[model samples]
Target: MPPAPASRHRTGRRTHGLLAAAEGLATAAALTAALPADAHDGGGHGHRPGRYQDVQLLSFNDLHGNLESPSGSSGRITELQPDGTTRTVDAGGAEYLATHLRQARAGHPYSVTAAGGDMVGASPLLSGLFHDEPTIEALGKLKLDVTTVGNHEFDEGARELARLQNGGCHPTDGCYTGKRFKGAGFPYLAANVQDEKTGKPILKPYWVWKKKDVRIGFIGVTLEGTPDIVSADGVKGVAFKDEVETINKYAKVLQRQGVRSIVALIHEGGFPASGAYNYDCDSPGAGAGISGPIVDIAKNVTPAVDALVTGHTHAAYVCTVPDPAGRPRMVTSAASFGRLYTDTTLTYDRRTGDIARTAVRSANHVVTRDVPKAADMTDLISRWNALAAPIGNRPIGYISADIDNTGDESPMGDLIADAQLAHGKELDPRTSLALMNPGGVRSGLTYRAKGAEGDGVVTYAEGFTVQPFANTVNLQDFTGAQLVQVLKEQVSGANAAAPKILQPSAGLTYTLDLTRSGADRVVTDSVRLDGHPVDPAATYRVATNSFLAGGGDGFPTLAQGTNDLVGEDDLAALGTYLTAHSSATSPLAPPAADRITVVQ
Candidate 1:
């Protein structure tokens, strides 16, 4: 089923190029300074008498285009109950999300729907098959007003992101649907992202939302270190700026335009101690509860900004963090996928055209499957699935049980490493073992799912979801001493604070002693290959993904490997390994994931 071009009920516009759009935003700022917008005489915008108006701010983040309900851990969220217990609630899916957002706006008149970036990329087969055109159509139907740009928005590079923003058939795919792709209804704001040649923002820096003279300004910024996490090819000609400085710069611009109420939609966030969305950071020890780059960013951002909507860390929290001026401002994240939606109410001060900071209330709400499936989103999913069926429905392999990536080490990670190892060995017969980055494993291999052909069947779509990066299996030679350093770098250098543990295949093992500090945690004597202690002076052929070969995810020592040999794409290698090794009668079981012996 070739996708029919999405039928449009509304036409949207994008602010392309920095110079002209920045000028437009500057003019908006000047107008805001001159006029006391949203002024009310102790009455509504109309002649009717009313108190301060309530502006409903509905926000979510990291939607990775999960049109269908996700399976395994990714599809669920933790909810702390009233009785001090926590329950795992199955959440997400654009179908239920649409219903929830629509029902949430039932009585609110001054409502604005927004997102904190990652609205696409790393998507499931349904949306990814059509280049996420379905997700954009769903956002338009959901009435999303604005959103920030996320690093994933640049996954296919700036040119593709522009295509998604403006309108066009994919340059390669031509047109999957009969209809032409009309980009996002909401602007993908990127205040800090600048063109390398011109030094101006590549997209709109900010967006102004006005209704009945009530104007709320929004400034969007992705993480400052986007270049480090994304593929080098994607960010080759783009430059990312300081998050705090960029947001503060745009916040002042909004204020100068007389827009007193400002919200920063950031694509970076902090981690929370508790998995429960309602876990209160207001508790005495909540400072310890929240950590990561966003903590410092929230502290330093301008006090003029009213609130912050954030993502990237994929943790959910509703907390008050004081800004530089010591004013308590709300900072919130709704986790990843379509699992959560943050419902915030802001009291709009008509006289000042600003948000009443003291009256702000926010909380993360689960998109429970109990709600009726939104018909429009279901139709959208069905349409995309029909188009995706031929290529996506092919059975790839069989699983005896779910192979998941949940903790420091995961079965799925080990499986990918093993697959890469086999492919690498085929390329260079002397390849000793393989390694994998935890972030590269996108989702788990679930044994059972809601819409599957069989209990243990893995489809081409599921395989694609797991290995969407399209990295190749790379073989290289490294001295045993440098190999030890590679393990140490997982916890040292750029990864000192947030250790990015590398997943290793069978026949390679090491002891990670968390009781020690820094590089000392990697016990040199315990590093072994094939049950033999690795000789410091010996050279060994190793297998890993191209990302690791290029020093991605802070493992810089891997970049020093000599005699590079690139093999098959990691996805195909994994699929081939699965098919060759398993069948319905003898399905693949989850790897033991015993490569790293961790001592706490």
Candidate 2:
């Protein structure tokens, strides 16, 4: 199929017209339906026939504000073959993505663009510094209708997010009016998120829209653990409710109002399948299996809801599972940072006021740079780049060596860990070795001389780009046994009997023998702390960022630790630590590797 057209579909800075028109049209119908509180429920003044012939739902999740393409090698999403070797694919960025989304929207009478969550926050400097305003603008040009509140959205707090949605609190130019920031042409939904006192969703729970004869409902929800995951200050008064309950309650209301078709835009996701990171619906086998709270919600959500779109895991896939009614429930998620586009076709039955079965088709398409940039999207990204150029373009720091992501042990990973340890040590004297997770390193350090431009200079902008999530630094005390358990998770699969043991950061290193089966892959026999054999019964002070400490990366061990020091934003701590101790003079050393010894 030919690629989708670019945002250039609409020209000029006055594009808000398109957005306002879309929302005005949708809201008008909703207000009309919501009014006359006495209107016949379901029989509402003689079931005004449906409007839309068929609706197309185009979604992207976990954008992380990479309005421009990002640099760095992601995890090896290798398809472990029968022969033991693996195949890999590189993914990411937004410029090339516009073309894919445009293509995905073709032929549908009413197509809506939406994102599950993490569209911003933990963003690259180009979009991060302006508080991800550029991302809002980029998504604006793309014509997004509604987005769920992901954990990352609260990085700056509810007030700041509201600023991003409506307008900013400051006199700054892009502070308030979302138009100024390139926000989606629509409002954000928080169906499961409620204010502590009012008990109503802090943000609108769901949005009802009219297209042709169809009354389509779009409901948005963030993960229930949002408060626990976001910065403590960002979610002070809000409470995330049960996803299934929230959706069911709203689904019933929409059903009574004669709205039958529903699509959930949520920010939670499942586990990686096999060893590959990307997934497709047509692919054979189970694809990747889902875990966590989302799986339960998707399985139990009111059958009235026709489709569920999710994000937050950042993996890609298009899959289906049976809902409460035994009907196939289509669920999908695009990879993070604008690397993939998820398209789901929702077919509504005009005659029965219901959604058609097997009519739902969803797919996750990779966004490759090889494709020509849509003229208009390129222009949108260019304009934002121009606005952010001075700060993002200016140099701040430089690297003396190349931090290649060839293996588990790399200089970049070590540097990140050291920074975390340094930050943690200041907060608590007990902090000894910092354990950084590889998933947290978004970019790599470039090796360059004093004047080499592309030589990979590590600047302040570059630093933030590497660790953009802003996860706080946390201090914890774990018994050597628990610490070992955390270490063992690196090799655990999502379906593994125990927690998946992902790689840990440097304290003392040892070899990991993949051949050693399950938890045995962690060569605990060779593991050490400060060059001495670790006593499994002993306790140790471990320093890690809040995400991992909070049990992100599937490491529940961190959560069970003794002292829980909160409030240290990882990115801030990294920046502060780097500036205080290092200069261009600091030498970058690769984290020495004794782990992962592959045998012939």
Candidate lDDT values, in order: 0.80, 0.64
Across 1-600, the per-residue lDDT of candidate 1 in tens digits comes to 111001100111110011111111101000012223443334535575344577899999989888789889989888776687877878899998898888889878889999999888777777776778888989998899999998888777898889989988888777877878988878999999999999999999999999776789999999887876777877778899999999989988988888989999999887776777777765553234577777899899998889899998778887777788877778888888888888887778775677777777777778888878889888888888888888888888999999997777789989999998888888888999898888778789999954667999999889877776667788999998999899899778877777778889899999989899898888989999999999889999999888788877777788899999888778889999999889999999999989899898
Clashes of each: 7, 31
What's the C-alpha lDDT at position 185 in model 2? 61
For model 1, the superposed segments whose C-alpha errors exceed 4 Å read: 1-51, 285-288
Model 1 accuracy (lDDT, Cα): 0.80
Q: What would the TM-scores of all predictions be?
A: 0.92, 0.75
The TM-score that candidate 1 achieves is 0.92
TM-score of 2: 0.75
Q: Among these predicted structures, which one has the highest lDDT?
A: 1
